[model samples]
Target: MSSNTIIEVKNLNLTKGRKKILDIEYFSLEEGEAVALIGPNGAGKSTFMQVLMLLQRPTGGELFFKGDRVDWKKPIAYRRRMAMVFQEPLLLDTTVYHNVASGLKLRGFKVDTIPARVNEWLGRLGISHLAGRQARYLSGGESQRVSLARALVLEPEVLFLDEPFVALDVPTRAALTAELARILRDTRITSVFVTHDYSEVPLLAETVTVLEQGRIIQQASPREIMTRPTSRTVASLVGVENMIPGKVVGTQDGVVFVQAGPHRIKSIAAVPVGTNVLILLRPEDIRIFKGVSRHGDNSFGGKVSELLPHNYLYKAVIDCGFPLIAFVNPEQVMGGEVLADNEITVQFSPDKVHLIGQYD
Candidate 1:
C-alpha cells in the first residue's frame, strides 16, 4: 500500500456453505475517494463490503491497511478506523442521542465531549431536533439519518455504506446524498458505497465498480462507465436504453462502423471487422426534432409509441424501425406540440454511441 492507498484486498474469496459468494482478485480504495459498488441482487456486493469492514472473514487472500497486513484477531483496532451503515438502520430502543453517542461511549471518550460530538453529527445530518426522540418511533428516513449520524460521529477514516438511501423517497434521498457528499468532502473520508440505483451513481461516486455474478466485470469512472461500458451487461446496468445488435461493417482510426439491419451506426469504440457488437445509446443522448433536419450523425423517422412521466422528465418510447426510448425535460414535452403517434425525426451524435461485445 502507498500513502494514498487506504485499503487493499488481494485475491479475496468467500464461500457460504457450498456456494461461493465473492471472488475478487484485486481491489483497492484510495484516501478521500468515493467508490460505488453496483450490481444486481445477489451479486455479492454486500459480501464484499463485509470483507472490507472486517465483519466477515474471507476464505482466501489478504487485506492490507496503510501498508500493513490486517490481523483478523485484532479486528477491533482496524474497525475503529472504519464505520458502516447497513441497508436498514439498526437503532436501539433508546433516545436518538444515546444511539448516536453509544459508539463514542464504548470507546471511552470523555463525558463532556460526547454530547458535543453527538450534537454536531445530529446537526450535520439535519436531525438535531430528533435527539430527544425515541429511536423506535422515528420514521424510516429519520432512522436512516440517525444511523448515518452515529457512524459519521465517530470520525472514521473510511466509511462503508450499503444502500443507505434505499428506503427514502426521491427528494429525501437526493437531499441526504448531497449532505453526505459535502460531509465526506470536508472530512476527506475514503468511502465505498454499494447501490443498485444507476441514477445515484453520478451524484455520489467518483469511480464505479460493476459487479456481476460475484465478480467485478468493469471498473471505471461514473462517466466512463455510462458512456464507454466494456460489455453488454455493463451497458445494460448503466441504463443504456438502446442496445441494438449489429455487425461491425468497418473499422478506421479506432472507430467501429456497425450495421444493424439497414442502419449504419458509427462508434468511437474499437471492434474488429466482421465481429458482432451491440450499439448502446443513452435515452438522454437522443434528440427529437419535429422536422427531418440533419443535426446528428444518425437520423431516423419514428412515431411516438408511449409517453410516461418520470419526475421532472418525460420518457417517450418511439418506434424508429426499432423501438427506442428518449428522456427529455418535462418542460420540453409541455412546450412542444403533442407527440401522439406522429412522424418525427430522432438524431443522435456518433460519439454518444458505445459499442460492446455481443456475447450470447
Candidate 2:
C-alpha cells in the first residue's frame, strides 16, 4: 500500500455455498479521492463496497488501511473510521435528528458537542427543515437526505455509498447528485461510490472502476471510460451502441482507413494495415443528416431501419450495408426528416472513432 492509499485489497475473494461472488486481484482507494465502481447487475459492485466497509468478510485476501494490514477479527476501529449509505434509506424509527445523531452518540461524542455537529450536517445536506420529522413520514428524497446527513455527520475518513440515489425520482436524483458532488468536493472526504448508472459516474467521481463478473475490467477517468472503453462489456455499459468489426485497409495524413462491411470508415487510430479491429462509436457521435451529401470524411447514405424513443432522445438504427446506431435529440426527431425507412446521410469524424484490436 502506498503512503496516501486509504484502502487496499490484494487477491480478494468472496464465496457463498461453493459459488464465487467476488475475486478481485487487487484494488485501492487513494486518500481524498472520489472513485466510482460501475458495472452491470451481478457485477459485485455492492459486494466490493461491503467488503471495503468491513460489512462483509471476504473468504480470503489481504486488506490494508492506512498502510497497515487490517485485522479482520477486530475491524471495529476501522469501521468506526468509515460510514456507508445504501439504496434504501434504512433510517431509524426515531426522528430525523436522532437518526443523524445516533452515530455520534454511539461514538461517545459529548452530549453538548453533538447537537452542533448534527445540525451542521443536516443543514449542509439541506434537510434541516425535516430534522424533526418522523423518519417514516418523510418522502423518498427527504429520507435519503436524512440518510446522507446521518452518514456525513460522523465525518468519516472514508464514505462508501452503494447506489444511494437509485431509489429516488429523476428530478430528485438529479438535484441530490449535484448537491452530493458539491459536498464531496468541499469536504474532500475520500469516498467509493458504487452505481450501475455510468452517467452518474462523471458527476460523483474523478475515477471510474468497471467490474465485470467479480473482477476489475477497467479503471480510468470518466471521459476515457466513456470514449475509449477497453472491453466490449465496458463499451456496452458506457453506451457505445456501435461496435463494428472491421480491418485496417490503409493510412493517409494520420488517418487510418478501415473497411467495415461495405463502408470505408476513417479513424485517427494507428493500427497496422490488414489488422482486424473493432470500430467503437458512441451513438451520440454519429451525426445523421437529412439527405445524402458529403458533409465530411466518413459520410455515407443509410436508411433508418428502426427509430425508437429512448428517454429524451431517439435511438436510430441505420443500415448502410452495416447496422449502426445513433442517438438524435427530440428536436431532430420533430424536424420530420428522420423517420423509419427514411434515407439519411450518416457521418462521424475520424477522431470520434475508437479502435480496439480484435485478435479473433
Candidate 3:
C-alpha cells in the first residue's frame, strides 16, 4: 500500500449460505483517483462496491481508510465522509432543496451554511430552477440531478456511484454524464463507480477493474483494457469481435506469425513458436476495400458475408479464410460499392492484432 492510498481491502470474502458472492484478494484506491468496476450482471461488481461503502459487510476482510483500520461494525464516521448515488434517485418525498439539504442537516451542519452549499451544487448540476419542485414530481433526469446535489453538498472525501445513469434516456444520460465528468475532473474526488456501460468508463474513470465470479480478472487503464484484453472473456466483454484461436507457426525480427483458420496472421505480440494463442482483432481496427487489393502485408481476400448499418458507419463481416468484423464508413462503402455477398479485401497491421497465449 502506498502513502497515497485512501482505501484498501485485503482478503475480502462474502459468503451467503453455500455460495460465495465476493472473494477479492486485494484492492485499493489512491487518494483523488477514480476507478470503475465493470463486468456482467452477476459479476459481483455491485457487491464489492457495497462492501467498500460498508453497506454490505464482508464475512472476512480488513478495511483501511487513510492508513487507519476501519471498524466495519461501527462505520458511522467513515460513512459520513463518503457519499453514494444509486441507480434509482431514492429521494425523499419533499422539495428538491430540502432533499439536497437533508444530508447536511443529518451531519449537523449549521442552519446558515446549508443553503449556500445545497444551492451551489444544485446550480452546478443545472437544476437550480427545480430546487422548489417536489422530488416525487420531478422527471427521472431531474430527480437524479437533485440526488447528485444532495451528495455533493456534503463535500465528501470519497464518492460512490452505482450505475447512476442506467435508467435515464440516451440524451439525458449523455448530458448528465458530461456534467458529472466535468464535476469529477474539477473536484478530483476519490471515487468508485460500478457500471455495466462501457461507454461511460472512459468519461468517468481513469482505471477499470474487471470482476467475474467474485474474482478480479483484469485491472488496467480503459484504453489498455479495450485494446489488449488479457483473456477471451475480457475481449468479449470489451467488444472484441474477432477472437481467432491460432498457433504460432513462425517468428522473425520480433514478428510472430500465427496460422489461424486459413490465413497466416502476423502480430507484434511476443509468443514462442509452437504455442497456441487467441488472436484478437477489434472491429474498428480492420479496414475494408471494395475489391481485392494486392496490399499483401496483413491483407487478404474475403467475401462480405453481412453488412449492417450502424448510425453513420456500416458494420461488415468478411470471410477472409477467417471471419472478421470491420466498421466501414459510408464514403468507403459508396466508393467501393460494398455490400453483402460482394468480394472485398480486408487489411490490418501486425501491431493491430493482439495475442493472448492459451495455456494447455
Over 62-86, each residue of candidate 2 has an lDDT whose tens digit, in order, gives 9999988999889999999999899
lDDT of 3 by residue, 1-360 (tens): 899998999999999999999998999999889999988879999989999998888999899988989887798989999999999999999999999999999999999998889889989998889988999999999999998999988998899999999999989999999999999999998989998788898999999999989999999999999999998778888889898889999999999999988889889977999999988999998877767876757888899999899867999988887778899889877876678899888889898999997642
Candidate 2's C-alpha runs over 4 A off are none
C-alpha lDDT of residue 77 in model 3: 86
> lDDT values of the candidates?
0.87, 0.92, 0.90
Which ranges in model 1 have alpha carbons more than 4 Å from their true place?
251-255, 331-338
In candidate 3, which residue pairs clash?
Answer: none
lDDT measured at residue 350 in model 3 versus the true structure, 0 to 100: 93
Task: Point out the higher-scoring one by lDDT: 1 or 3.
Answer: 3
Per-prediction TM-score to the true structure, in the order listed:
0.93, 0.97, 0.96
Find the candidate with the highest lDDT and give its number.
2
Ranking according to lDDT, highest score first: 2, 3, 1
Tell me how candidate 1 scores on lDDT.
0.87
